[model samples]
Target: MSVAVDCSSEETADILVESQNSSLLENETEDIEEFFNVAMELAKNAGKVVRSAFSEKKNINTKLTGQDLVTETDQAVEKMLISSLKERFPTHSFIGEESVSAGKKCELTDNPTWIIDPIDGTNNFVHGNPCIAISIGLAVKKELLIGIVYNPIQERLYSAKKGQGAYCNNEEVTVSGQTELENALIYSEFGAHRDPEKLEIKFGNMYNIIMNGHGIRAQGSAALDMCGIACGEADAYVEYGIHVWDIAAGILIACEAGGIIMDPDTGGKVDLMSRRILCASSRSLANQLKNQVTPQSFPSD
Candidate 1:
């Protein structure tokens, strides 16, 4: 006896569609993997520049204010990264802190763009502090895809890929899993803006955290602070007046490590250019921190 099987035309079309979708997904994965490898290598090379200048007396320059310092190492590293990345990805967009400060427009289009801070903790780097990071993040249509922050001095490397868990030194990491504010180890900074009025508001926010949390720590480096959240060293991090480059990589790494990010003001979705951030190990903690924060006004970055 012969058995006959009939397949409907619609079923065939559906199968074809599924296959096409799978192919597209595979291509996207491969593309991102390539981008990630390039980014990681660039971060290591940038670290070399930072390490070389760590012990040397540096040529320091002020950007917006005297406290907002930028060293020659910062410029050299940024130039090296931009030059190398442009060669590899000529069509992609770029936003570097030094470049933007030098008047390059900070625009995020739908194109793949690399957001970079050659040296995240410039003040710390200037003062011989090792809490600095070479931060690099890639975004497509404002969707973060990869984040890599390497603190060469401390030999700590934090990284993440979209939909993939965060890692520190090749080992997966996670948030501290503390929902209550009292149990949270909070990280914050006064930021580079020292306007007396702004400082007054910032201090008020700090006081709130100091009174409510287990402890408040100030690292002067937003990237490293966020990494602390990822690796369970800190439970919450809130800051205002930080540029997108400062937290671009850190944000993804923290979120990938089972963290939550929100706007400190409205507690809504984060706006990267808003110059504000609040992140925690859990949504409950994030909401608590959000309520405790009193944000100051600053022009969008």
Candidate 2:
């Protein structure tokens, strides 16, 4: 769990050279490991803040829509995470949910940047539910390099670095390898968007999955839902009207776990900034989901 970079050691350098996606030079590998370590530490500290504030009723404010709630704890946690991360990587940029709520820009750059959701399941957290987590994703040159999601309540830590395998609680994890949709467990989220047309599309997709798949779950947190797929707890996940922070970490985690994520609009390719995403335990299952379920365009807002 220690994030200390040891690329200087001959053994560490050999391992990186032999790993998947091992194209990175020694310096880049060291930089990425440093970032990953800093991010994991920040996520753990943020989890503590979340746990200490979970039991009490806190002030909540609406953002963009009534369904989107932001609590004082959310703001405080983001401030803490950003502050701590910035101190460690001063030149790197950050795009956090609270900063966006405060009218700051959410644009991503090709530089080393941190995409953070201080509390991914804010609504669930507000309701005293434990289905929440701190999602931290590190993107370098516009490519996700490291992802970490910590569910302090459940004490589940899911993380992955590009070219490295995915891990849950330090154990290597993988997708369920369910190729058939009918017998596959699926996960999806009803986003904050309440537009009737969008809602109809979401419900219709849910209905199709329900009648075809083994079961469907609305886990409230996109990060956790995708992590579920990464660890084989669920076979697939689909969502629309979500942001980069919501799915950034999950994308890397799922892919590192041997899962496939696609943009249904792009004929099954991936676009990180796409507001819509379809993911499954395997490439075959992803294709099945894409062909079986038609995607409807929603207001991107």
Candidate 3:
């Protein structure tokens, strides 16, 4: 039965706005699907590059300090990722760790950008530690909407598209719902820096976690650490002196898997370029960690 009712102008306007919002959501979903499929392929291809070079001795070089290492595989994989993605998305922007190290500006704009960290755990990769990852994250209009982190050595692929939840190797996964600080397992990888001042701050934060939390482990790979939170293997992760590429992909996957992320210092929305991060299984747990952890800073990426 149809009712012949007169609608107010405000009601009509609300309907129009709702319709527009629905249309926008649908379009964004379509774009996400297209982008996700392409991203999946790129991650797999990048994985192949990493996998092929895993056991081979690499030409490793130190960056900034003797502790910060970069290998030939890192450069090759970065180039491969940029080239392939550029071929498919010429207009897209990029922020790659290797590229930035090579003199490119580490800038983020409103344009669609691909943040790539070809070998997130380069030190681990060099040590044949199987804890490395090919991390790719997409930010459009300065908001992260897609993330892909592939550990070719471990064959663990974690991914997410905004609103669709997170996955590991095609299986949906979630965070361990341990909200208490005493019960949480924490991941902190920050003692490698030679700067004694930074090391002191990093270690102090670690000390707090150790005293308060159930236990701690240093994964050496921030991307995988966040994925560990997403897959319920870990309860929390915190890092200072990490760049955008290190946590961008992992942030989305972890959040989609019912985890929470924030600035360890402020407990606010994390500034992707700020080089600080805290990820936890729940808001209560994250807030608890934020309260205990010592704050530290680094130059933005």
The number of the candidate with the highest lDDT is 1
lDDT of 3 by residue, 56-169 (tens): 988999998888999999999999999988998899999999999999999988788999999999999999999999999997767677899999988999999866789999
**RMSD, candidate 2, Å:** 6.2
Total clashing residue pairs per candidate? 0, 0, 0
Arranged by TM-score, best first: 1, 3, 2
Compose the digit string of candidate 2's lDDT tens values, residues 1-301: 0111111223343222112234543467887888888888888888898999999878999997999999999999999988998888899899898898798887777677898899999999999889998999987766677999999999999999987889999999988889999889888888887888878888988888898889899989999999999899999988878878888888888877877777766544455565778878866677767765667665331
Ranking by lDDT: 1, 3, 2
Give the TM-score of each candidate: 0.91, 0.90, 0.91
lDDT of 2 at 80: 95
**What is the Cα-based lDDT of residue 89 in candidate 3?**
89
Ten residues in sequence with the least summed lDDT for candidate 3: 1-10
Between candidates 1 and 2, name the one with more favorable TM-score. Answer: 1
* lDDT comparing candidate 2 with the true structure: 0.80
Give lDDT tens digits, candidate 1, residues 137-234: 98775667789999999999999986678999999999888989998899999778879998988899889998998989999899999999999999
